[model samples]
Target: MAESKDLLQVLWSGADVLRGKMDANEYKTYLLGLIFYKYLSDSYLAKVYDLLNDETPDDLQEAQKQYEEVMKTEDAKDLLQELRESMHYTLEPDMTYVSILNDAKGNSFNREKLQAAFNRIQESDELFNGLFADVDLYSNRLGTGDQKQSATIAEVIKVLDGADLIHAKGDVLGNAYEYLIGQFASETGKKAGEFYTPHGPAQILCRIAMTGQENKRGLQVYDPCMGSGSLMLSCRNYSTEPDYIKYYGQELMPSTYNLARMNMFLHRVHPENQHLRNGDTLDADWPTDEETEFDVVTMNPPYSAKWSAAEGFKQDERFMDYGGKLAPKSKADYAFLLHGFYHLKQTGTMAIVLPHGVLFRGAAEGTIRETLLKNGSIYAVIGLPANMFYNTSIPTCIVVLKKHREGRDVLFIDASNLYEKEKKQNVMNEEHIDKVLELYNNRKSVDKLAYLASYEDIKANDFNLNIPRYVDTSEEEDEVDIKALTNSIKETNKAIKESNTALVDMLNNLTFSSSETETAINEFIEILKEV
Candidate 1:
């Protein structure tokens, strides 16, 4: 653990090397990509040393030396093939991050070598295609000229070279990567939403979605609008058989998609287990191949963002069940929800975060809500506190759904007041999250905190599904002690009258230093006498 902390400290210093000169979004690409490159290089050399010598080497430099010697031997081709089969990628000596860092130390580093290395990685495997597409070593933003850019890139590499990833465990490195992602999200503000989900809500989403499926082996989880794959990755923490868990996700933004790809690899997800894509999840339905539906589904799509919502979308299988209507063009919230919902197994649970508008907004959204409610798909609604997100302060809700559940009764939990006020944002700690889970498990009405509404209750409200309409968080006013309050007021007035009379008498005895003082004292005495 201490070693991991030190590694994190070493890794974060790379951010300091490029902090002031770069934007948070831009610098995160450089910082995370460089660190990821170091991980690959370090892990590669360590694996080679282990395979060749049957022992893990303590020093990466020594491993690199031995690896170079081996490449010149007759077994090199066999070693490369074994590497491709095991790690899904292979690195050349000249293209390795260790080699590049050594060159940086010798003042011989250049951008083209790093670019070649990136191209080699992309070419080495299908999983790594365009994996490092967002890292721009040649960008003018790095510096004013090519020489300066090379120097800047070299500086970043050196700053990240101290992490000792060869000795680090998977979770250690994965946690360090997650920490940097969170820091970037904090600094990037609104743009953060494109690639990151805040940790608090992420915990709630994963825990709720993985409640009963935690112990189940071979759990397949999918996220349609996965941001950085954090929400989907979060499910691993709740599982008893995490190694058997498979992940499927899609994201709209390419840069954000690339981040998710790197995030999956950093978390040590098996290449075969990571099924992610960079495409518009709503523009076209996906996962039309094998294993389309999953054991668990989660989403945090862009809230109320505009989509084409063309008439042609009515034919999309994901939306066709809703009486020939699609989500409106102005708000894609329901579009994303239905996309994830369509791919959920009958026994699986899904959790989605969106603005409060989705609960009560009439017209097309209302019709969709009614259909979902009548079908018993909407299971539970959890209201989160406002100012909880990096991008927007509007309070959001998590709508939990299960396909063909037994009843239309929905659990509504008003956790809006359940968070602690952290710096600039509201955070739900473990205690708060546990309370929510407890409420969900109990599935009973708690005064002002949660409510279990019957289908008739929701229908009476015209299928509004608004939490406040179901779970009234309003507190009843405390009964007034009128007689006791009157006596207290009389005693307070009596005390004030006694103090005022004493003050007036004291003022009358004071010898006036000037006519102005005498007049002021007289006016104050008159005011006090009236009081």
Candidate 2:
């Protein structure tokens, strides 16, 4: 644990090397790209050292030297082939991060060499085609001219080279990477939503999605708007056979798509098990091949963003089943939900974070909510605290859906008031999350905290799923005692009247040198008596 902390400190300090040169959002590409490069190079060399045990020396420098020497021989061809098949990418002897760091120390570093290394990695496999596109080493944002750019890149490389990622455990390195991503998200503020979900809500979504699948084998989990793959990764924490769980996701942003891929690799998720794509999730349906439906689906899409919502979309299979009415072009919240729900298995569960407006809004959304409620697809609705997310402070809710559920009741939990206030955002502690999960699993009404509303009950409210309508979380006003309050006021007034009389007597007894002063004192006493 101490070693992991040290590694995280070293990696985080690399930001200082480029703090003023670029924003955290921009510099994140450079920093994360280099960390990924180091991880790849380290893993490659470590594997080679393990394979060439008798022939290679044990010392780090000596092992690297021997590995390079071996790579120059004809034997390197077979080793490269095996590595490519196993790791999905390969690095040349000179393309390793250690080699670049050694060159930088010798003042022989150039941005072109680093650029070429990135190009080589991209060309190595389809998964890595555009992996390094966001990291522009020669960009003026790093520095003004070629010399400055080269120097700045070299300095960042030096700072990262100090961290021993190869010696660290996979979870250690992955945790540090996640830590840096979170730090950058904090610095990035609202834009953080583009690629990251705050840990609190992410865990809640995961728990809700993985409720009954804890002991199941070969469980498949997916996220449609998989920002940085944090929510999908969180599901693995609860899985009994995490290694067997297949992960699938689609991200809209290219940079974030690359981050998700790197995040998966850093966490030691097998390349074959990870099926992440870079594209708009709602622009078109995905996974065109086999395995359309997933066992568990989770999403935290952009709240109420506009979409084409073209008339042609009514024919799309995902939307065609929802009657002729489509989600409004102005708000595509229901579009994202339907897309995810369409891909959920009959026995699967889905948990999505959405704006509160979807609950009671009439028009097209109301029709969709009514359809879902009648089918018993909406399982549980959990109201999270406001400001729990980095993007917007507006309170959001997580609607848990289970297809073909036997129960016709929908559980509503009002957890909006159950959060710890921070300096900037409200946070849901473990107790808060566990309390919600406990109520959800129990599936019982808990007075003001939770309510199990039947389909008949929801229909009575015209299919409005507003949480407050079901779970009354309103605090009771204190009861008042009018008679006691009136008596207290009368007693206080009597005390004031007695004090005024005493003051008047004192004023009358005092002798005043001037008639004006005596008149003023008498007038003051009269005013007190009137009060």
RMSD in order of candidates: 2.7, 2.2
TM-score of structure candidate 2: 0.94
Candidate 1 segments whose C-alpha is farther than 4 A from its true place? 487-531
Per-residue lDDT tens digits of candidate 1, residues 467-499?
889887777899999999999999999999999
Q: How accurate is candidate 2 locally (lDDT)?
A: 0.87
Q: In candidate 2, what residue range of length 10 has the lowest lDDT sum?
A: 54-63
Top candidate on TM-score is 2
Report residue 511 deviation for candidate 2 (angstroms): 7.6
Give RMSD (Å) of candidate 2 vs. truth: 2.2
What is candidate 2's lDDT per residue for 299-402, written digit by digit as tens?
A: 99999999999989999998886657788999999999999999999989999999999999999888888888888899999999999888899999999998
List clash counts for every candidate, in order. 0, 0
